[model samples]
Target chain A: MTGLLDTLLAGLALGAVYALVALGFVIIFKASHVMNFAHGSMLLLGGYLTAVLHEHLGFAGALAAGVLATAALAGVVDRVLLQRLPQDPRAAHVATIVTIGVDILLVTDLARRIGGDLLSLGDPWGDRVRTFGPVTVPDSRLAAVAVSALVIGAVFALFRYSRWGLSLRCAAEDTEAAALQGIRLGRTRMLAWCLAGALAALAAVFLAAFPATGLERTTGQIALKAFPAAILGGLASPVGALAGSLVIGLTEAFVITYQSDLHVLGDGLSDVAPYVVMVLVLLVRPNGLFGAKGAARV
Target chain B: MSDAAKHLPRLTAAVVPLLVLCALPFYLESYWLRIGLFSMAAAIGAIGLSLLSGTAGQLSMGHAFFLAVGAYGYVWFSGDPGPGLPPVVAMVLAVLLAGAAGGLFSPVAGRVKGMYLGIATLALVFIGHHLMLTLDGVTGGFNGRSVEPMEIGGLVLDSGRDDLVVLGVPFGAEERLWYFGLVLLAFTWFTARGLLRGRPGRALAALRDSETAASVMGVPVARHRSSAFVVSSMYAGLAGVLIALSFRRVVPDHFGLVLSIDYLAMIVIGGLGSVGGAVAGAFFVTALPLVMAKYADQLPLVAAPGSPDGSLGPTEASRYLYGAAIVVILLWAPDGLHGLARRLRSRLRSRLRREPPAPPHGPGPAEPVTPAPTTTAPSVPVKEHTP
Candidate 1:
């Protein structure tokens, strides 16, 4: 019972972190209709910034700087590169491929700079744990859950009430209609990219916290796990992303916890459990759990 | 002009290149031959991907999975630990095995469309990797397995029998494999071009442009989609067999997500939906890193392999260059190298004739022009529902 509880807590904490990244994917897809493949590298960039600056700026200041810098970089990428492309439906697919190119560039440069070295981000919680009855949890895990819930709640509120959110929703619904109604599609889309970037940066902190061995170059690849999370929820749904992340998190946690019993599936089943779940899910629901079936008009 | 007279120049143009490629093994060193071999193998795989992702308008990120099936299948069929069949039979069976794997996944492949298909196929790569690692009996797990050199009747294609001489040049493994790669590449080119130009090619292209429209025109959408996938997998399998033969070893690491991405990059950089483009792109993408690594000492700002100093290495440098190349090519050219070459040739021809250059319209003097679609037609039929 205690082991199960421990696993549940760990899964919840992982899901929260994954939710942060998966939510980024949802926001970007909703606004621009382009799957952001460069997101993994962007997370790495944010983490790298925080890691390199924490020594001088302190953890809080460095984290704030990192998030803001990442947001700015995403905004610039949209304004400078993606926005310059011809505005057409086909451009969305092209933009997605372009992101793959950008990812390669970012990952290569960052990996070269990192060079097999692990750097600490100097978080407030360093190997600290708190025992709650039968279960012991890391301070960082608790912090992750609390912070993610707060941030996600605030984002939901913003989406529900903010003017930018209204414009973003309207634009995503119908680009031409929204444009006629005086919404700046470019600005709304760019803002969505910036917001997603900020979320990814925040998630990077938790990803590199206790239990993980600091920030390495391949840390970006861990962010790729969020792809299954995002896709499972449907690309356009934020709430779905949260649910999907939790499901994936729980599945991975259970698989790792019970690896000895499931030895027939081979070692390291946890690493690929999310993808397996995703494929099975997709087999049943082509558009994802929450995605609507689009009807074609002749 | 008579038809034969008109075709003479084109025939000579094609024949000249063929002669040059055939003669390369005799003149070039083993290192260059090895590079050529890898490029040829990559070209075959890239051509397969081009058919599926480029011409058929489906996106696949699991190509590496099929390639692995071929590699491991060949190793198991021919090696002592398994069936111990003849190398030629093993090679054919390996390709068929890859096709059967595709057949197993056809139901999903047929139903999934565009970007959705791409993500769905991502599952295959992870699953395939897991299977490769776990099925240690066949795949040799992490360390992988050695490949048996191909033998036809009595002629061996490995350095183990290094006694043969050809025109005063020692016919080593690289030398033998060079001709073998050329033959396979030729087969790929012939088959791929034929498929593209035939009725099936037209149907696939139509489907890519508009699935609804294609189906309305009496094209069987699901069957065609799955068949394209099967054919593409077969090509990837053949490429895998050649890759294994050349390397003399098969490892799970070589067939990873990166290899799939590399194949995608090849088709895109070459000019999607073009056979010549796939070949060119494969050569460029494969050779760039290797050539850069070879001449790292001469290149500025690139540290040698394993250098302690924290500087950009040849591998990283090459990656940056190609990554940027993909972006720049998509941005500026959009039509890729094949298109660029076509335009250049047309311009040169016009200049020689002293006639004013034809306005850059659709087709030029190129034979049987299949205009490569610039974008994949939207697979999702209607407006996305907002929740």
Candidate 2:
């Protein structure tokens, strides 16, 4: 029972981080209709910035700088690279593939800079644990859950109240209608990309915090697990993304916990457990659990 | 002009390339030949990917998984501690095995639409990687297994065999593999072209354009979608066999998401829905890094591998180039290199036929050459037409 509880707590923290990243995915998808494949690299960029600057600026300052820099980078990528292309709904898919190229370039440059060295982000919650009854949880994990909950709540509130959020929602519903309503589509799209980048940067801190060795080249790849999370919830649904992240998080945590019992799958099944759960869910619900069933008009 | 007169240039264009490729092994050194071999293998895989993603409008990221099935299947079926089948039979079975793997996944592949399908296929890469690592007996666990050299009749393709000299050049494993890769690539080219031009290709294009419309026209939507997966996997499998043969050893690490991304890049860079484009894209993508690394000394910005900390390495430079190319091509010329070639050819033809005034009703003669964004800006999103 303790083991199960411990695993569940760990899963919650993991899920929280995934939710942040998945929400980023949902935001980008809702705005531009292009899945930002460069998201992982963006997360890496944020983490890399924090790692490199923490020594000079202190942890908090570095974190802020990292978040701002990544947000700016995301905005530039949208404004310069993505926005230059015509917004043809038909060619939107091609535009999505272009993100892959951006990802490769960003990832390559970051990986080269890091180069087999694991650099710490100098986060305050270093190797500290707090006990709750029979279960002891790492402080970093607790911080992850708390920070993610706070951030995600703020995001949800923004969606519920902010003018940009309203414009985003409207644009997602009907681009033509939104455009006619004079909701600057281009600005909203850039803002959306910026928000997603900021969220990705925040997630990077908790991801590279205690328990994880440090930030490395492959840290960005860990963000890829969130792809299933975002997709599982349906790309357009924020609530779905949160729910999907939890499901994926719990699945991975449990899979790792019970690896010895389930030896037939070989070791390291937890690494792919989220994907397995995703496939099973997708097989049952094609558009994801909460995805709107699109109507086709000939 | 007579039909024969019209066909003469086309025939010469086709035959000349074929003859040149056939004679390349004798002329080129081992290093260049090896690159050609790898490029040919990549071309086969890219062709398969083009058929599935470009023609059928299914964005599959599980291509590497199918390629793995082909490669490992060949190794297990042909080598000891397993079936020990004939090399030719093993090769064929491997392709079938890959197709079977695709068949197994057809449930999701058939049901899922566009971007969703792409994400769904990603599961195959991670799951397949786990299986490859765990299934130690078959896949040789982490280290992987050395591939058995292909033996057909009395001729052994392995370097261990006695050397055969031809035209003062000693025929080695690279030389032997060059011909093998060529035959496989040629087979891929003709068959892919045949499929694209035949009934299935029309049906697939229709499916891509609009699934409901295609279904209304009696196209078996699910069957065709699933079968495209199978055919694509088979091609990936063939490519895997050739790759395994060239590599002499197969490792699980090589067949990862990066490989799938490379395949996608090839199809996109070459021009989606164009077979020749896939081949060209594959060669450019596969050769870029290799050629860059080889000539690192000559290049301005690039340093040799393991030179220093700050300088740009050849691998990094090539990646930057291709990555920038993908963005630039998509923005400037969405149709890709094949489209560019088509535009150039049309322009040349029009220039030669300048005496006749062009029809005003049709697309302007200069339009194709220029890659006018106005014409292609609103082609249609992948999801809009799919029900």
TM-score of chain B of each: 0.90, 0.92
Model 2: reference contacts kept, as a fraction: 0.71
lDDT of each: 0.86, 0.88
Q: After superposition, how far is residue A231 of candidate 1 from its true place, in Å?
A: 1.5
Q: What is the TM-score of chain B in candidate 2?
A: 0.92
- The collision pairs in model 2 are A89-B381, A90-B380, A90-B381
Q: Stretches of candidate 1 above 4 Å error? A: A91-93, B345-387
The alpha-carbon lDDT assigned to residue B343 of candidate 1 equals 57
Q: Give the per-residue lDDT of model 1 (tens digit) for B31-84.
A: 989999999999999999888877788889899999899989999999988999
Q: What's the lDDT for residue A139 in model 2?
A: 96
* lDDT of residue B170 for candidate 1: 88
